[model samples]
Target: MGFFEKYLTLWVALCILVGVTLGYFFPDGFQFLGQIQIAQINLPVAVLVWLMIIPMLIKIDLKALSGVSKFARGMGVTLFINWAVKPFSMALLAWFFIGYLFRPYLPQDQIESYIAGLIILAAAPCTAMVFVWSNLMDGEPHFTLSQVALNDVIMIFTFAPLVGLLLGLSSITVPWDTLFLSVIIYIVIPLVIANSWRSLVLKQKDGDEKLTDLINKITPYSLSALLLTLVLLFGFQGIQIVTKPIIILLLSIPILIQVIFNSG
Candidate 1:
């Protein structure tokens, strides 16, 4: 891992602090940026998400997707946790904590929205950060790449429906059109463009070395894009966060539990 990736937690912490500081002092600036949306998706965030995801996707060998059989055990475990467990587990946790247990403490108006957000967060499989985590854990790159590709494929098809179902079960209204637009914009478009770009790079002379060099060069930019996105998100949500600081801590409980459960 690079220095930045190794200390990613520290960087994210710093970014959060900076974002909140900026948001608190410059609320109008962040609010204007937040208004840059179409189809209920922020255009700036969509662009940043692409920047954050595409570099990681470029590292994947699409041909290695067929090698899933080589790591059947690991792949099976991954699929089970990612597809069958995490979303439902997060939903249940949200309902238990956000819906009933912590209901009185949280903003009554935003309880359903919080549950829906958690559900959506959990439904989407890990992609960009999975590469960093796998590398940190000394995992097989090929297996990790293949699993990510498989997850992306399934996510494109299932994300909206899964989120919709979970939200519906939680008695939250499902914004089907916005959710579907997000899936297409965030997943499908990036996958197509990244794969095409990867294909072209592979056809060049010394393509392997060239691709490695390119990835190395662009990896920092991708990470920077992610930090920027986080800043924007925190900035946009800063007012609410400042008022209800406990909201972040409370919401994190279920996410932390879900991670520990899956990791274990």
Candidate 2:
């Protein structure tokens, strides 16, 4: 790994600290940035997401999509974990710990919201960041791309209903419109742009060379954009993180469990 990739965790930690500090000092600026949203998706973060996701997607060879079947076993495992296990298991964990065990310790009104957030977080698998993980693990690119594509399709259909079911079971209100909008904004649009750009790149005279050069040029920027996105995300949540450190820690139990469980 290169220096930036090798020390990503340190960089991210520093960015989080910087983001929180800036956010705490400039609440109005951050709030204004946060308010520039459409359909509940923040505009600046959307741009950064595009910058981060598009370059990664550019590395994908859609022609290799046909070879995805060769890695059926790996894809199947990913599907089972991401769809069948992660969300439901997270819901159960949220209910057991947040609903029952941590009830008295957490804020009364926000308890349901907290659990709802956890359910939402786990409802869909990681999309863009999976590329980074696949690289880190020396995983097959075709398998990673295909698995992500399949998960995206499944998520489009299942994410809302599954979330609604789990949240209803937990008696939490479902924000249907916002959820759908998020899928469109985050998943649908980025996929289209990435593939479109890929097609354009491949149409050039020296297609492969052009694509490689383009990817090399923009790849570094992708990580930089990711760091910026993290800053904005942390900035938006800065006050909450500061004020409700204990609640944040408690609410994170299900997420920690889910990660450990899935990674195993």
Candidate 3:
């Protein structure tokens, strides 16, 4: 298929339709899949993470990263938006919309957990998928990689405290060492593997085109996995969502705004 032939939004829509239909028809099966989790990570979603991330790693130009100064502006903006601005705004919005306007509407106690989930999503440093958005918007690729790498490093020390402070959740905890390990496993390791493999196979020969072509071939599989994961995530949340539409929407407003303002 041609480049435009494969569209992510369309694919995601189909996945959602199929997932909802299957869930309605076979709630037990989908629920079982959802329940099959070793820790917080689910099996199907782990596969999606691997597939979604590895392809983007192949696109990283480790060579271009040397001139990191060239794209400092974009990098700075991304960092500021993520660290300095996004989290606080998310909390403020959640407090206002959910605490005041929508509080009386919810079942009372569940609002805290709902806000907690949004806070977790907000606190997470963007990885794996930011690459896709940057590329789509014709962003400077090496710059994006550099910023992500630096952000990953900083987040190792900052994430837990920042999240806890923002949400006012004193008991909130993250396994920092494990989070770093995840960064290594997801971003650092993939970067090293992809770049090393590329250099080995195509360095002496001018085969960059061929390497890109090969990587592009596997794109659909990764996308399919991502779509599948998205479907599963939404299906699980769908019931609660319908139950408390206004409250949930109010809680997620901050995150939605952050995504828009930053990605715009």
Candidate 4:
């Protein structure tokens, strides 16, 4: 592993502390950033996400997509876990932990909302971060890209209904704009930019060597962007995190459990 990848946990922890501290000290600045959003999607974070994923995306070979069929069984398992198991399991966890176990600790008014939020979070699988994870694990880039793309597509159709079912709502207002825009900004745009850049570089002299050099040059920036993103995220929730540490801890337990459960 590279140096940054090797100590990524430390970097993430430091970033979170810095973000919270900065947010607490300079609330106005972070608030200004927080308000720079469209359809509730933060633009600056989107840009950071682009930076984090584009280098990884650049390494993908579009021709490899044709061979994705070879991973059918693996893909099937991923799809089943994502669509079938994850959301429902999270809903159950939320109910058991939030609605029942931790009910006395949480505000009565926000219990349902908390449950709903967890369900929504579980329903929408990670997209851009998958690249970072795949990179860290030395995962197959082609499979990672294809799986993420497929999940994005499935999320569009299933997200609202799954949330509604879990939340006991007959209908839910899906954030169509946020969903579509996120896909465009995070996936479609990055993929296009990466592949176009890849094609251009490969047409040059000593193409493969040049491409490796370019990716190596930019890899640090990708990881840096990830750290910045973490800072921004923690900054956004700094006050809340500080004031409601217990609540945050309680909420996080299920999320942590869910991640471990799903991974296992």
Off by over 4 Å in 3: 1-7, 35-39, 169-171, 203-206, 242-250
State each candidate's clash count.
0, 0, 0, 0
- Cα lDDT computed for each candidate against the true fold: 0.81, 0.81, 0.71, 0.93
Candidate 2 regions off by >4 Å? 135-139, 169-184, 195-206
Superposition TM-score, candidate 1 onto the true structure: 0.79
Quick one: ranking by TM-score, best first? 4, 2, 3, 1
* lDDT against true structure, model 2: 0.81
**Can you list the residue pairs that collide in candidate 3?**
none
Flag clash pairs in model 1.
Answer: none
In terms of TM-score, the best-performing candidate is 4
The candidate with the higher TM-score, 1 or 2, is: 2
Reference-based TM-score, model 2: 0.86
For residues 1-264, could you state the per-residue lDDT of candidate 3 as single tens digits? 445435767877887766666666667777888886644556666556667656666776777778989778877887888888777777776777666777887668887776766666776777877765565454666777788888888787788888888777676668765676667656776677767766665765657887877677876666666777778877776555555667666666766776787667
- Top-lDDT candidate index: 4
Span of ten consecutive residues with least summed lDDT in model 2: 170-179
Q: lDDT score of model 4?
A: 0.93
lDDT of 2 by residue, 30-70 (tens): 99999999867788987887787667666767777788788
Least well predicted 10-residue stretch by lDDT in candidate 4: 132-141
Task: Give per-residue lDDT, candidate 3, residue 73.
Answer: 84
